[model samples]
Target: MCRLMVYLGDPIVVADLVTRPSHSVMKQSFAARERLTGGPGYIPLSINADGCGIGWYAREVERKDGDVTPGIYTSISPAWNDVNLERITPKIVSPLIFAHVRAAMVGTPVVQMKCHPFSIGRYMWMHNGEIGGFSALRLPLLNALRPEVAQKCPCFESDTAVAFAVFLNQLDDPMVQLAPTALAPLMAATIATIRHVAVQNGRGDETSMLNFVVSDGRTVVAARYTNATDEPASLHYATGSAFRRKKEASADFRLEYHDKRSRLGLVASEPLTDEVADWAQVPPNHMVVLMHSEGSFVDTLVLPIDCESPEVQDHVTRCFRALDQSIADNAPQALQQAPGGIPRALKRPSFATGEDVPVATAPETIFEETGQSVLSVAADGTRVFSGSPAGTIHVFDLQTGKLLHTLDDHSHAVFSLAVADGRLFSSSMRVVNEWDLTSPDGAARARPRLLSTRHHSDGDVLALAAAKGVVIGGPRDVSIHVEKACADGVTQNSEATVGEQKGELVRARALLTDALTGGHVSTVYAVVVRGRWLFSAAGDAAVKIWDLDAGKHKASLYGHAGAVMALADVQKQPSSGPDADAQKERSNGSDAATSPSDGQEERSDAPDGGFWLLSGGRDNSVRVWDTDTRECVRVLKGHADDVLALCGGFGGRFYSASADGTIRAWSTATWSCTQIFHHEDTVPLAIWPTERGVGSGAADGKVRSWLVDRK
Candidate 1:
């Protein structure tokens, strides 16, 4: 069996677990002390020397923009012989780590992809044991996976890769955060599914050794299991305040315990230190869970894996039957698609339609301000709010096009504006101010009253989004500041400003409570909140999804070749007529693409009303992503320059404004550009869609509203 080790606790250099320990993973590659001998059709060897891999989450200081995904390094060379590992491990540090040294099974080729610690999206997995008769059960296991999961599966000829696929299939949404308690059961179920598949295929009697460890950066779940009566491959875990060598030159490394709370937790296929008391053996058929909790503590749990239970067996059988049925129905169509095998709905369709693209009629209303470039715009049914470099927020009546108010609370240019919860939020420099839309003095005043202000320490807040009592601001420093309202639905600030009649100034309250880093690798350009999920786009050309409740990164979407500048959430409207029905029929090849999987039922805060995310990037394209599948469903390419702003969910069309000095409106149904509005001599910096048409904020200090003919 291969050797595996995982760390989930305080930040530690990769060398601490991979090479520095007396009985480290690197040392075990040549001298494994507790490795079991003999397996079907395999030569017994105490040494694991085929290859090695390590995956770890980068600390904030390690990368420019905080990245949530782990950085992985793998080598086909033996762990003990890999010179690069020695030099690299000492420089990388992480709070969660997974390292593996593989001893390839007899007849299996040694390749880089075959190395342990296989990863897909945010999750990383490594296996120390083999699935007996894996060759016989491989086909059935592959066929059991959902189409999307099957597509994500690496094309590797190893049981570990297929097992990882099976595990991912057990998750409804692998792109979201999952608790260790919830994850452990899924691991057990994955093992159950594998056993059921093997038994159904006449490999039930084969002794299967399945030692698996999986982690999502924050939580780790490891299992040591075997159907045979012989003791499973050695697995042990040690918890302490820290894990380090007693002396720099000494080989005596142990877990240092200072208090009851564990600040360091390490799991390994074999002990990594000579101190026997520092490690505890994981019982056979049991899984160990290590979850990072508050107060810098790692909570550990050891639970039995009950795969043979009648209830679990029934569930697996039903799931397998359903998957079989699905494959039988869609396999033919899937084979007929492009070599990429991506569903037709998720592919970019031909854009050769010769039909004339419509041009928007002349401006219905134009609001001009001398010497002030409009940088951001937002609308709330009756009124429009536009932010300018002149440090003023201009409010106007949407229907009447009347200049209603100019709020001048900011001393710097306001780069972002968002309307949420009957309030307006504007960000300038490092401060975000919340304004009550209904005047605090009286409605006759027609001016918003300042309610609260949040100060960010990172840098100037360039992007802002607010929803569900949570405000998210992306600063120029490449981090996201998250502020949540208290239980009373309001954040109380000690400083209060009296109305204009009182002539008293109120300093905005500081609401920068938690900041999420390691999600982006460059300057965060845009941020949007959909339900409880936060979508942040950055100059790194990636859009990252985060769980707002836990303040954890869920998944990253990569496709843009340049900085992603804007983001919008569009709720899918129910279609009508025969053509709409036919469209739905065509998309049935992947039903999971349209909605959350059954496993996401526990996420009560999941966005409602089926929404798709639209992201615009400096690559001059807009991407439509299915929130459920976390896959880019479509790429709308027509922008001639960098797409700087996006606004949608009005009149079945979404608007995109670009540096090319034009605003293009795309039909949500056809994913085609239907109308384009040009601004002469200036670029459109921001856009806000209304019931009749769209409004644009241009660099030329003008705000123009264009109306499109419904027909």
Candidate 2:
């Protein structure tokens, strides 16, 4: 067994993958965490000291027409002890890289030629597992390869080399660039062919771990498979917007997803970093394909593979024979049928031509409170809840735009509203009211009966967030109040207050307060609860992160030039495939709010499903911050005035309402403004994202819904 890694994304120095990480491929050479033991042909040695190799495509600036083949370097020395590798890797940078550290199979020689990654024409390949009883099947495997592929094969005495030959034999022209869709199936077919040969030679019962990775400069496909039941060699992958070494001298690395689209993709036999959440195990019998999309973002796809299937077995046999005959007959069209049942490559709509930009039509008045300015808006799956300055909460059907109920709860203006746990929470001066959406009484259900009202001793309640029986209220003052629902139908108040008291930061299990000497220094404008962490946007131009469990200040993110007025959490979405739906459902069902700007839903706090915080600032820009890294990855500046409200996680898009009288829809994939809904002479105060459009509360005393065509 060996350690191998593949990187397909932004250009990075070779050391980033091979040498620098805490558990990099080089480190895995000696201290692998998940390599199989006691398997057929498996050596008991813990160290992969046989050899080391790396292959990388030339940087764009150095690439010429026919000279784009990758550069390869191999040495018959332990990767850690390779002085030449250490000296040269830091100086080499490439966008696509394949690296491996070998612990050669029982009979394999420790020669430079034996070290992966093997290259033929424009492709590079690396293997992490051994083929059981390969010595008996070598001649048969070579004989099965097409004559042209056999002529070009390097004849290296390695199972990986034989597998590479089989892979090339399936390609009509090994030198021609193939799409990831084409490459993925051919890779699957290669595994099937190897299995067929193993079964033919009576080695079917023996374990054959075929963890392989192949790349054609622009596209990459990696497989984790084993003929035996035990698990395939520990293959894992991670995707994010940026992959960075935490500190200059530290081996720790971080993969941050600033938004939905992934800018980096990594596949490895062992995790490169100690951050457990950063890596996801690739299923035993599956392949992961990384390819560049037309939108210029990397797309990752995980596909299941069944080597035992008769259809797959026959497909591999016929694919190669058909390819060889096609080459002889000079019939390129026959190559179309060569790749069978492989999922077609995803062709995402290109954002370059503005085709994906949403079209915002005229706003349809959902409800008009005659003379009261709409102050807050929140939404669930079917209803739009709008709060007014008159303390009246109006519920409207999302589909019909008809008023469902009007409840008078507070004596003061309603500034914020939130929906969570089948309840609606509305906040006003010195009090927060909770209404039961699932109330048993039919009459009370339509007009959700006010369950409880907690009086705040501080200033006006400016923002509200509720989840898991706890309600957090951000006040006009620099303090945050926590209210817990008691089993006895009462409310328990625990104020986490932060203020200028004695210029010292206060800490408590429930009370939270930032000192004027250090923290917020102004009113808390918005509060969002995600898991055990509470995020508060304040008038001090900063967003502070609080650990709810500890009730202590964790970190403060600062980038806004002026006061941060509105805050929303845009839950990160899976880039592609079946997992996207599962991940989306998980995000929607958990702490992450479906409509973040509504200040109502509990946004997903699944630590692994990272989130981006969108803060609308008085600086007239909306900044996107990666909560994990606490870094502002993007600052969207299109609003001519201060951005007042923000909402995201609606069909790969986010919307921002500005005091400039416009609500702008942004594509989360591109981070570009796609559509703008103008409110004429009024400032849109709050926005909530819906399935088909966005609902807004504006200064013009109207609750409106705008149809956003995102298709």
Candidate 3:
């Protein structure tokens, strides 16, 4: 018996979904709630008695500042006992995740590499059930793998893992790669290859549990089928928005089927969750596929035959002809559909050259220049939140550059700043302090209250902000810590506090601890909080999405030219059409499509309500990407120096701060520069929107308040 979980949605932390969930994969190894083989009598369950394994892949993120190769992790130990699980779960995030737990059906090997979810280069394959004639047909199947693939087979004797290698090898064959007009045909060839050797080796009419899964680190394909009469195993698939929603309303979240945004199609022998509506049974002898397109399901028939029978020769020949026909019939349709299974092509962005406009206008005069170096700026419309490298926090008038009040509350450089709930939170080199910054003069000589203290271990604190919660990102500790407003108000000294509540706060406390620390090789650069998720960019050249409530990673977004320095969520249009039928056919997770077994009405894809994410990098350009579609909507390039910070306004206005000592504004639609405000002595480090308007903080210890026409 084997258990598997496939998650497609926002990148989530492996621990929150795979390890810590009520019915987590970790628990499934010993105490699986639902068994595919009827009841749990067939296989004994116990965390200590049963062996477990997990396999996962991370996405390759491209940033303007850097790029990262995708990462994969596999384990053989019981997930709960493995210290590494706790170590790496929060640190790594991916949008598309696959996890599996094993309860060996037949061939139980002591070695770890023999586990399912096998990998060949970027491709990973796993099988839930076993082939009925594996023992008798092993030799024939092993021989079917090309010599190259056979060579990669396990030294240890596990049938499932070995079978996976064979499948991967066959997939790499030139024939399958070049001629896959339809995946069904290629899959048919694989099945034929397996049957050929089984009979030649004198195998029997074995009933095989062929619930198969494979992914090339991008597209994932899973199938459930058996040669038995009744049904292979209990397999289920669920799709819709509710399956992907968070488990909690707070930032601390869990996986719950709330909305239908999450379209999950699971092909398990038995349903993982008890929600009957959340699971659907995969019909006998049929294959379900999850690709970019929603309608990727296809049914194929493979008649079972006895090995060593006179019909063997006929079976082989028939198999070849059937495979050829299936492949030919499926090729044209698959090719016509573009990447991500969407039939329609994405629109190319329009760009303009400076030569087209000989005389570009300068920024309109708004706020009188404040002669202070701004380290970070966030404004609404009536009030401004500004911080300086000199450790000064200020609140000023957006309409006029009148200095509200200067407070010397911090002791180190304020590299980043954010304002929310009428309070201003600023992060220095080693500490996080909050100012009762509702009014302009709130910072005047007023000592800021300390909410939390984090020891600096990496290097420096680069970014910080406060919203529904407090978020801090920097080079050394690159972790996010949230202190609810109720957690405020402790004036006790550090020694007394640590001794008193260390035991209670140690458990179930969502605060950032030593475990959230970054790996020595990587640095966290910036973090942006939106609803229940936290998006972080790192020195590793990746942008990771974390689910705050669950305190785990959701997904990792890649596709940038450099290390992501800034992340901002803006608005955008729907890339697909309005017809309900057409939209349902399109794929959502990564670039794979899913087709339903029962022919049903199609869904439409029109512009729905969603925001676009803008990330700036050392690559010296800004990319606007649709969060829902995960497609790059636009790319704007004009910065002279590295773009260090970015902020988008509520009125379609966007602003960026750079090493070139200037804050530039852009029209989100045309992506054209609207204004360029040059700083003489101050170098803009970070920028954000405040209650009053847009504000820019600089390296020269000055915070500038800017007023823009919102029309």
lDDT (CA) for every model shown? 0.71, 0.69, 0.50
lDDT of 3 at 575: 31
Query: By TM-score, is 2 or 3 better?
Result: 2
As for TM-score, the candidate ahead, 1 or 2, is 2
In lDDT terms, which candidate is top?
1
TM-score on alpha carbons, each prediction: 0.45, 0.52, 0.41
Q: Give candidate 3 regions above 4 Å deviation.
A: 1-372, 380-382, 438-459, 470-472, 486-521, 573-609, 678-682, 690-693, 699-702, 705-711
Supply the TM-score for candidate 1. Answer: 0.45
lDDT of 3 by residue, 1-711 (tens): 677766543344556556665556666667765555623434553332234544555433322232222244556776667678668775655544667766654335544675555665555566777766677667667766678788867542666766676666656542223321134344545555565666566553665676676654334455666655756655555443223213453222222321111223334444444444334454455444443222121111122222233322232233223223323233223323322231111111122234332221232223334555555666644555666545666766665656666667666445566667755666665455555543346544343344434443322455564565444454333345554431343332222223226332211225342211211112356777777656676433345555565555443444443346688877653432223333322112322221111121222221123666677765566766554554454557777655778887755668877655566777765566766666554456666664434566554444555556544
Clashing pairs in 1: 66-518, 66-519, 67-518
lDDT of 1 by residue, 411-473 (tens): 766889998877788987667888777654556447887767766654457789988666789
Sliding window of 10 residues with minimal summed lDDT for model 2: 341-350
Poorly placed runs, candidate 1 (over 4 Å): 1-355, 440-445, 485-518, 576-609
